[model samples]
Target: MAKKLELGDPAPQFDLREDGGGTLSLASFAGKKLVLYFYPKDDTSGCTMEAIDFNRLLPQFTRAKTAIVGVSPDSCASHEKFKAKHELGLTLLSDETKKMLEAYGVWIEKSMYGRKYMGVERSTFLIGPDGRIARAWRKVKVPGHAEEALAAAKSL
Candidate 1:
């Protein structure tokens, strides 16, 4: 496993396909703060709630000059369906290759019902305009995560 990233560390670079057919690069957010969240799957309960929460705070994040993007191993098509079904207002990135997940250190072994397997841990990273991570949340809980991230971004 890659070392866990800490605050002030340079955010890992990525170029991935976004939902609804478009590309997004980490460099593209160069002059803007970002709320980069990693979720396990599209259309799942927790993931859906998390996306909705972020969408609900979209205007606040915009006023704070922060862009929100959710990443998952699902394909762009899956993301599109999820976004449409949920009316999500933020961007969603497809990381089928799982390279970005590993680079961010969110892909790891997990257990449920006493069975262990590899999966993406729910995580969120607040990246500053200068590309360094301002804050990171591992094993994130969905309820107020979006608001928490926004608070950190606003402080940055």
Candidate 2:
């Protein structure tokens, strides 16, 4: 398992296929702050709400100079459908290989009704323009999360 990241740790690097037929990488946001959120799957209840909340707060995040991006272990096609279905205005990245997920330490053992499995633990990382993590929220609750992240970004 990768070591848990802490404040000031360099954010993990990633280069993945985005939903809308393009690649997105950590380097693409160079000299800009980034809000990197990880969700378990696309089109699920909690995931959908999280996406919508982030989308609704996109303009606020942009005003803070933070670009919001969602990542999941779903395919690009799945992300595309989810985005269209929800009218989400955020960039969704496909981490089908689970490399980026693991690197960020969001992929882990989960228990649901006595069934143990590996999945993403909803999390968010606020990366500063200098490529270091400014703040992180692990096992995030959907409600007010986007707003909280934005507040942190703005204060930074």
Task: Write candidate 1's Cα lDDT for 76-116 as tens digits.
Answer: 99999998899887899999999999999999999999999
Taking all chains together, each candidate's TM-score versus the true structure is 0.98, 0.98
lDDT by residue for model 2 over 97-132, one digit each (tens)?
A: 999999999999999999999999999999999999
TM-score of 2: 0.98
Worst 10 residues of 1 by lDDT: 144-153
Measured on C-alpha atoms, candidate 1 has an lDDT of 0.94
lDDT of 1 at 72: 96
Residue 106 lDDT (model 2): 96
